[model samples]
Target chain A: MANPTAALIIIGNEVLSGRTRDANLQFLATELGALGIPLREVRVIPDIEDTIVATVNELRARFTHVFTTGGIGPTHDDITSECIAKAFGVPWEVHAGAHAKMAAYYAAQGTEFNAARLRMATMPRGVVLIENEATVAPGFSMENVHVMAGVPRIMQAMFRALAPKLERGAPVVSATVHADGVFEGQIAEPLAAVQRRHPALDVGSYPYFRPGPVRGGVALVAKGTDAADVAAAADEIEALLVAAGGQAIRGEPRLDDNTTAKV
Target chain B: MANPTAALIIIGNEVLSGRTRDANLQFLATELGALGIPLREVRVIPDIEDTIVATVNELRARFTHVFTTGGIGPTHDDITSECIAKAFGVPWEVHAGAHAKMAAYYAAQGTEFNAARLRMATMPRGVVLIENEATVAPGFSMENVHVMAGVPRIMQAMFRALAPKLERGAPVVSATVHADGVFEGQIAEPLAAVQRRHPALDVGSYPYFRPGPVRGGVALVAKGTDAADVAAAADEIEALLVAAGGQAIRGEPRLDDNTTAKV
Candidate 1:
């Protein structure tokens, strides 16, 4: 089968206002990569109900799985669950399971569960709770859409809990050979050829800015599941770089290990 | 008047694959801030034309302006202009003005205008070109939707060109007062109170991770265009933080200068 496709929806006004630089998208993208699932798209919408409904409905129709990373808080702007319910035509009410969890949390803190805070317990019909280890309010999964918390810690915890449950393909494997003292344009053509040879692997070039304004090298990364295919592709790419008068540094075997752990 | 509202649609599948860490969202967010046009949301969708058209319609109905980046290049994935035209229900053809710009760019590069390259010149009807100083392919504005290049360097140039033509609101100003040795939960109540006091100004608390595993502290950022109001909110926020047994780091004065330059 093909790679499992996913999309992320980051909902908040704080992100767009420059009030916060989003760290969630980067985290989810890398994490999804490790799970052998390719994240296909991401959208950051505000607290608007109509916008949320429209985006969720459209994405659900296209992607196999959709993950939303905000607007599930206790505040009034946390309207994701309600809007999602409206979109799916599901009756939304406080989930008995989720409400019990929230009540216990508020009770433990010796705080009264106000009406506003109770909104956290509301969920779409027939959805399973994505157990939240960081907080009391659990995220919910409706069909293929996983609605998680906006808080980074909470979102991370929910993702960890859900990873094992997901259907994963052969995880995308990658190897990187770093090059120094070569311009990107000089190697773009040869890289294209390398890609053509290894249709199973993705060959990519990334140019970075270094000191002294030197024409810094490209990091040729080959991504796929088959180790032999990945290695062969990487070797072909490195050979081309060397032929183009650039040093291809074969560093540690674990050069792309972080990406492996990220998903 | 209310802040000039805008939205962004990032068209690409590469970004979602973790192959591309998006630089456009941050660039456009900061640019919109400088122009006093508040970017309320951002969506990254695949190369699907229907998704693009649907998103454009939804955003155009709500926002004062919509800026779409990517999908305007020579490749097959670049179909933003055609999709946008369909969204607006207007007949799209290669604008003579845009074609002239593309011809001049190809001439400068000493390359023939390949048929695939002409795709860049296709634009929606009744729109004016947003001059591309970095490259020959011009970005265009059809009604309120601005179609621009996806490349970071080119997007920045288009933004600079498009800024003067937009009607800006009173510039939004912000002040940050950092509190060391505090937790997010510890300050949530006081932050809420501060927000209640200054409804017009937005106050946000962001927790940072220290070198150690400990939660470093929260940065209390208050934003608004009114200098006096922002200052007042900042003063109150700092006082509250200090009272909560946290060290307050005085943030910079001007809010507009806080953005990181991309191009």
Candidate 2:
């Protein structure tokens, strides 16, 4: 069976302005991959209403799940909730449960539940709240679209809470075979042949350059839902590397394992 | 005048699979922003030919410029060049100049110029080369779409070489005002008013949470092509912060810079 597919949208002007680097996509990608949902696409866009609304609608229609991070704060730039509501053609209003939670939380902290803070309670009608134990405001799920905060800690917390609720498919298993001093060009044809042999698996070759002892090398990875297939393909890759006059390591090498490289 | 817009396509499975964190997007964003070109959108997609071809065609048609990184290596997964050629409906073949360069580079390194290595010389018809001083294989440009390597060092080198050839717009200037211990909710309305006052500037508010000494804070940034306008809006934001009973700092805090935030 094919794994469920997902798309991620990262919304923030800070990221587009190069003032901040996004950390959410990779974290989500790793988690979703483990849950048997393949992330097909990820887009980093600025916090603009038209762009956000269009992107949200497009992704939600294309992928089984769409996760959006950023622009859920209590500030002028925090327009994600409203844009999402607009995309679904739903009325934007403050959810009573979310409002009550934020109010109670702020009261306990001795902070006033001001109008600006109250904006966090706003969402599209009929959306369930995504829990945020790390922060006061909570993310919400409207259909397949999940909106979460941009902060790393808050985003992580929301994702952890939301992951269990999502539907799972067959989890992808991966195996890596590392070869030292093996130029990718020298073994490309054999790698292609190996890939052709296992048409169901995704075989990828990544080259890495290191200074001093380990000049450079390539890592061949085989990934599939079937662990046996992935392992078998990995073995074939190892054999191919050995036949090419290079030593193939069984697994990914640690940084300290550079001493095993043949100069 | 509005700046020329650009879109970026990150092509790799390692990034989508979460094995490798992407380092090219931010570098491109910063460089594009400084050169007065706004990076409007960035999409990270897997190393699939159909996806690459469709994405390349869509982006090249929509944006003034498109930059793609990854999958331009000498391996089975390196299909970006052929996919790009297919997208343009042009025939793909080995460029004599590129082939000569790669052959000479390999000869100097005492390596045979194998068929796989020769793949690096392949490109779409009527395309110009983007030099890669860090590596032997040169990237290529077919009209507005610029294809480069996935490695950070090589990508940077290619971008540096290509930047001077692109048309430059008016550079954006920015000013930031940091307010410590200021809850964003307390000043959201005032910030919105300030934003309304300067329609040309891009006003953004980013919240920060620190331990021990500083509990939480927010940075209000004003960006625009006009320096004086950006500075004026920043000053107004600082005044608004002080009016809301918060200690406003002129510049962003040092050291407390959240390095843990993902890039």
Candidate 3:
């Protein structure tokens, strides 16, 4: 059977305008891949309500799950919840559970739940809260859509809460071999053959612009849950590189941190 | 009036998997901003025909201009033209101009137009060819949507060709100042105030991370089209930073490389 798939929507004017370099997408993609839930789409849209609504609807309908980042903060541009509510044709009202959480958090801090901050509690109805230990306001999930914070630290926290709920597949395993002084084209066909031989494994050749002063080489990585298959594929690929007049050094077989191990 | 907006659709499965670090989005965003046409959205989709068709329709309807990258290569995944043609309910055919250009290019290289390579010539009807001086198969445009290559160099050439056709506003000018020994939060309010004072200009603060032996700092950038306004606002911002116990040093003004001065 095909792996479950997910999509990511990044909402923020800062990201689109090149003001903020997004680190969340990379993190999410790597995490999802390790879980064997392939991320199929990523949309970066400005914090425009209509754009967000359209994207959320389209992506949610297409993928098994959809994840959104940014615009969940207690600010004027933080319109992610409202847009998501609109997308699902639901009412945009203050979620009681979320509001109570926010109130308790502020009460502990000896601060009033200011109206501006209360906006963070406004989430879609029938959504499960994704805990955010880093901040008072937590991210929430409605249907298959999981809304998370934009801040990298808070996002990581929210994902930690949500990860346990999702069905994970066999852990993705990867083996890499470093081949120094090799051009990409020289090994493309041999790598393709290796991939063809091991249909279950994902064999990839990546040419890195490694800071030549320190270390520079082409890294061939074979990844899949089937350890023996990936190992055999890596051996074949490395041998091919060696025959192509390149020095191939076999590396460690490590668990891909991004993929989730089956519970 | 608000800036004329554009949207980009990146069609490929390779990118969303974290397999390819996306370079096209940044290049297009920066280039479009420099030409005064703000890029409002970017969507990276897999090679699914239905998804591409739906996104193209939605974005084309919402934005003034739409540009799509990838899926135009001479490979099996090169189905952008067919999908786009289907989306518009138009007949799909090989673009004669595109075919002629590709034929000549192959002939020059002493090769025939193979069937696989010829697939790049197919485009939606009534589209104008966006010249690709860097490669044989050119990107084509229909209505407001311009379909371009995915490779960075080729995409850049296609963008350059389309640049002249676009009606640009005053180019967004930008100036940067480096500040050492100051945390990002320390100057956020002052910078926000500077932005409030000059609403036209966009003031951004970026915190830099230095490795083991180097010192870290923050870079404040002021960007907008009105030179005197941005410069004056930047001056005031610098003064505020200096008064706030930060050492701010002006670096350089960003240049418009896409457009040439008509002397």
Among these predictions, the greatest lDDT belongs to: 2
Candidate 3 Cα errors over 4 Å, as ranges = A85-118, A121-127, A132-137, A169-263, B1-3, B88-113, B125-127, B170-263
> What local lDDT score does residue A184 receive in model 2, on the 0 to 100 scale?
86
| Superior candidate under TM-score, 1 versus 2 | 2
Per-residue lDDT of B115 in model 1: 61
Candidate DockQ scores, in order: 0.22, 0.51, 0.18
Model 2: residues with Cα > 4 Å off, grouped in runs: A254-263, B255-263
lDDT over C-alpha atoms for residue B1 of model 1: 74
Error of 1 at B21 (Å): 0.5
True-contact fraction per candidate equals 0.29, 0.62, 0.29
**Model 1: residue A47 alpha-carbon error in angstroms:** 3.8
Candidates 1 and 2 compared: the better one by DockQ is 2
Clashing pairs in 3: A34-A258, A34-A259, A34-A260, A35-A259, A35-A260, B173-B224
Candidate with top DockQ is 2
Task: Flag the better candidate by TM-score, 1 or 3.
Answer: 1
TM-score of every prediction relative to native: 0.72, 0.96, 0.69
Best-to-worst ranking by lDDT: 2, 1, 3
What TM-score does prediction 2 earn?
Answer: 0.96
The better-scoring model by lDDT among 1 and 2 is 2
TM-score of chain A of 1: 0.92
lDDT of 2 by residue, B1-263 (tens): 67888999999988998888888888998999899988889999998899999999989998889999998888889999999999999999999999888888878878888888888898999899998567778898999999998888888989999999998889887898887777687888999998899999899988877675657777789998899899889889989989977888987754243421210
